[model samples]
Target: MTPKAILLHLRLPFSLFLMPVYWFSISQSPHFDVTKACWVFVIWHVLVYPASNAYNSYFDKDEGSIGGLEKPPAVDKELFTVAWAMDILAIVLSYFFVGAVFALAVLVYGLVSKSYSHTSIRLKKYPLLSWFIVGLFQGFFVYLSTQQAVLHPYNSLTNNLLPAILSSMMLWAVYPMTQIYQHEEDAKRGDRTLSLLLGIRGTFFFTASIYSLTALCFWVYLPLQQFLLFIVLTSPTLVFFLNWFRKTWLDASQANFKNTMWLNLLASFGLNALFITLLILQK
Candidate 1:
């Protein structure tokens, strides 16, 4: 595959949205191991994430719109086959690094991701279900799976329940922003997205309110030591709310979309990086 195609498939920018939960796991663990963290990151980033993107691209024929891609890099007709191969390879390899259960999670996520955009069961056409599934899987499942894999035998869903739920809530808050921005295009394509159902005015309010609530939850749920750091890192999310709730909110310009997107991404990335750095320093 071409280098550009590979990079596009990696979707590094989009990965920012999920980093908080991964870092949360690291911060909360007393025996955080960098080696296992690296392995899980690779499985999630290098293989699982890329394969999901590439597979979605192949079937969506979105003219490259889905998965935060625009003008997607061209690929061979066998791209779908290659995507599936990569996914299976990643799942198999997960057993070696994170154990059988974690590997099974990979397989489950792989199937779910495939069904998301696959022609036979295109979940993307149903906006609410699509958003919910993507949020739950990419947000909650990624966090849970990463934590379980990294923490190994000691980790249990019971122990990691709070972080997993918070992660899911965080993504659920931001997921509507993507749907709002894509409303026009999706509606034109006969896709009944939640944002389209909300309409522009309603969508703006919905996204702003959800984002605000997520920020509040972050403040309430973070550890005492992390409160100040979280605030400093994630404050820009408020700007998104302000801009989104402006009186002239009907102007769904590219600049507006990019501003909200980048702001939210920065909030997530900064929080994750801060949490990870603190964990490392403490260890």
Candidate 2:
């Protein structure tokens, strides 16, 4: 495979969509070492997430638009090689530069990601199961791991389960919307994605409900002033989502890639800004 093709297959830009999780993880950690946090970011955003994308691309090799690429480049065996190398590098770096707990987190996340697309143990084929685990892996698991990797919180888990669960809730809410535009392609490929199971309209309802619940949880958890600030900060994304949902409800065709990508961009920007503000305020 050419360098360009392999790089594109890595879908590095797609990793931006996952950044809110990184920021969420860091902000929630009880302790923050800038060095450890930076390495954690590098391990996940630079190596782990892209490797996951590459591995999946090696197997799927989609001709149509994938997550980041509008026209995806073809994949080959070397793609898997690159992915494996990245995963190995990430784990090794985590162990050396970060900590053993961080290293183990990288290992577990890598294995689970490999299973998602590997033909022998393809979790992507099961709609509900895949949906459940992807949310858990990318969200709650990420939050907890990031906290441990950076902060080594003596009580990594119970100290703040509701927030960790909120992370998962946010992911669970948005997971299917990413697939809403690809229902036909996934169906033809025999992949029963969460969006396919939900159907276009049901997907909208599900995303809105879960997202709203998460927001409400934040409302209850945060002080009145902080929650009000959140709503204010999140207005742009909220308005866009409601508008998009209304349009999609009228015509599922509105759920096309262009609109979907816009939503992803807006949501990522809003969430990142929100948490960064929170982090700064905490500091």
What are the lDDT scores of the predictions, listed in order? 0.72, 0.86
On residues 8-121, what C-alpha lDDT tens digit does candidate 2 reach at each position?
888887888888888877776656788999999989999999999999988876877777777888888899999999999999999999999889999999999989888898
Per-residue alpha-carbon lDDT of candidate 1 for residues 1-283, written as tens digits (9 for 90 to 100): 6766766765666766666767776777777567888888878877887788778767755552444565567666567877888888898888987689889999999999999776678787887798789888987788877777777355767877776777777777766666666666666667777677877667667766776776677677776667777677666666656665673365556424555566566667777777787787668
Q: Estimate each model's TM-score.
A: 0.87, 0.96
Off by over 4 Å in 2: none
In order, what is each prediction's RMSD in angstroms? 2.6, 1.4
Output the TM-score of candidate 1.
0.87
